[model samples]
Target: MSKFKYIVVALLLSACTSDDTDTLIENSNTLTNYLQDRSVENGAVIACAGNTEDDTVSVEIFFYPEEDATNYRLYETSSTDVDSNDFLNYNRIFLNDAPVFNGYLRKFTGEFTTERWFIVSFEKDNEIKLSNPIRLKNESQPTLFANAISINQQLSQMPLFNWNVNSEMNNAIFFQVLSTINNDLISGTYTYENQFQYYDTSNVILNITNGTPPDLVLGDDYKMTIMDVSVDNWINEIFVSQFTVE
Candidate 1:
């Protein structure tokens, strides 16, 4: 009788131990796979000013899941303060097409100024997975001038270019002049300092007397592009315009 009682007690203890072990395993799995692996990409801040009418901005995101997630949702916010819920707005949401991971693209466009902030968020399984933010600024536009030109009396010297001087340029604007023969390849290159609007009493001009000339072959077409300096050196909202060298 004593042996039987001891055996029964041992069996009960073993069952309790097994139950504890199973509980631990379940809790471990929940902690390990609690959230989805989500990330943000190509986040940028765009600025616009002046008489410009339309512009577009795009952003991309990539999400990875530990297991098969059937549904996902995306959210956007516009505040720098993370603690505040005032910026919450549903911009986009979609379901997963693939099982494990994939990429998502988002785009937003409108007239906005320095007063606004843009934020993007991603949610999976009702949990916030990722967030990204960008800040906007109103930067001054730059002015352009045509410096020097050479003219041939036999050729038509209708060399025209357009530019705007920046009143509030954070740094000097860099310029590149491109020219092509027969419209196949660029024949010449020129670089100049970006001029300030204060220096221009009138419109900025490019002329042959300045040592720059619009001498072209008879009956040949030419094209020119006066592009903005690299975005790395300048702030946002720096406007640039181009003209043809007739």
Candidate 2:
């Protein structure tokens, strides 16, 4: 996008999230200055999925970065909105300790709370690329596809996943994550429809950012989870299933 358009979007976002008039103006200026000289693109950060268990939560963040990208960084805040300038004050999260999948997805597990926000960035040739602010929401209800879907993993071919839903989705967006039994993310994407045959680009919204889909290890156990996120960003339902690649 043009630099002017990028700054305009940032200014509007800052205004919506800042309650104080002075803070809004300051945030607007910060965003304007930060994005002015940078190359900005939508979908740099595509999708985020979270799992909360009791008092703890695990979040999977996905991003597309340049092949030469280095010095990957994550910043955190307790506020509702975050901009590039906010990263200066936001606490940096060390990703060296997090599990990485396909060199694009990162997983972080920690105590659960209602007020945490995150943003991701990476440096390529000394220029930093930023991702949109992301936050995870708690699940609202069990998903209809809990035990209603069937997956066929054929050797040398993509897996075929089909499901049956008995209720209305209420216009929710579907997101799927394929992971190892130990919770290592393999591939993740969004689908607007109910059925997603693995690696079928036509049926998916945001295809995996990894250059190529990683092969699922035969005879090894794996997990598949599908979450429905509403327009408000809340997770309305989730389906988690485990299987052994036969």
Candidate 3:
């Protein structure tokens, strides 16, 4: 990543929503070739730029359209039944409802699988960037074991969230998980190493205490809505699940 110069998005437009801070000028002379190309090698998924060797990463970054009604920054888990989670980072990644980056290529290496999710943390209020998710196909992917499976039924408040972390993930800095209750969304970013089963005892608890948006209810049917996220052809995996409360 240090080898390439980032291309900052200098587009200017006008705000339309509460989350929108600056106007987006898409066709304007901001910066082009920000990102391009994608591939998988051994077990490492790579994102490429301008077809260069140095500019590559296992995860990818995306930006919201300059003008969108919904707050892209709001972390809303896409409907579980929809089979994909696109809005997982719109809110958690950016405070202003957009993205800003200047560079020719961003390269990364580390453990990657179908169950992994990655996100980039910038300065506060600066936009956040997430890698398109990937859920490795069991057949194509090596064995991924969950040390502890969590299932909470009956009366209770929000339960603690925990899962296995792949030990092979290399160069990973962070992990991002997004869950939903009906249409309500709850997102949490954690240290990448926490994904392994070794830390299941200290699982994460990302709740509505911070006041992100709509809260949960007594009973609701929810699902993780798994899908593979990618930029151009570079694809990362995300896993969804079916869970309920009673």
Best by lDDT: 2
56-140 per-residue lDDT for model 3 (tens digits): 2222333222222122321212222332232222222222322222221123333222333332222222332323333322223
Candidate 2 residue runs with Cα over 4 Å from true position: 1-43, 47-49, 56-66, 81-97, 139-148, 152-159, 163-172, 178-188, 209-222, 229-238, 244-246
- Candidate 2 accuracy as lDDT: 0.54
Residues 102-172, model 1: lDDT tens digits = 11112233343322333333343444433223333322232233332222222244343444434434332
Cα RMSD to the true fold for all candidates: 21.6, 6.9, 15.9
Write candidate 2's Cα lDDT for 88-130 as tens digits: 3355655542545545555445544454556666666555566
Q: After best superposition, candidate 3 residue 202: deviation in angstroms?
A: 9.7
Q: Using lDDT as the measure, what is the rank order of every candidate, best first?
A: 2, 1, 3
**Whole-model lDDT, model 1:** 0.30
By TM-score: ranked, best first: 2, 3, 1
Residue 6 C-alpha lDDT in model 2: 20
Candidate 2 pairs with clashing backbones: none
Off by over 4 Å in 1: 1-36, 39-76, 80-107, 111-114, 119-133, 138-242
